[model samples]
Target: MTVFAMLGSTQAMYEWAEKNQTVFYTQILSRLMPAPQRDDPDVQVNQVNISHLTNLEAATRIAFALRLGMQAKQELEERREDLL
Candidate 1:
């Protein structure tokens, strides 16, 4: 049950991420840029590069986190059933 809940939450998070990828990347770039006007040509160029790199990093991190969580949940279920 707990495992299912975790899986559901993970799925939901992934879905949300997928649905808002553009927004998420935009926000990330916005944060990376200096304050005030982020529309400067130089800032825009840097933001574009940073956004691409950060997007890849974010994807990798999410995948790694999900894999770890799934493994931990599976282990917990196995232990629970063994004690049952």
Candidate 2:
């Protein structure tokens, strides 16, 4: 929902989602929802293979990855300023 809003239009949202739908579930799911522990059986349930993803889900994953990159960039800029 939030990512769709950032995309600026229904068409853009549709295009981005369509482009990303083929990505494997593990690519995003593991980052979004990690098991409580290593080797946990619940991880299997989260690992279900799927051919397509909901538009909202795909948007959310892209939004999350973008946010992470933005944060890293901001931190680097701040560190550089401190050294100046």
Model 2 segments beyond 4 Å from truth? 1-50
Residue-wise C-alpha lDDT for candidate 1, range 1-84, written one tens digit per residue: 687587777687567768898886687557877878546565534222435567778788678879999999999999999999
Clashes of 1: 0
Error of 2 at 27 (Å): 39
TM-score for predicted model 2 compared with the true structure: 0.40
Worst 10 residues of 1 by lDDT: 43-52
Alpha-carbon RMSD, candidate 1 = 21.0
Model 2 deviation from native, Cα RMSD in Å: 20.5
**What C-alpha lDDT values do all the predictions have?**
0.75, 0.73
Instruction: Please report the candidate that would top lDDT against the real structure.
Output: 1
- Taking the candidates one at a time, how many backbone clashes does each contain? 0, 0
Poorly placed runs, candidate 1 (over 4 Å): 1-52
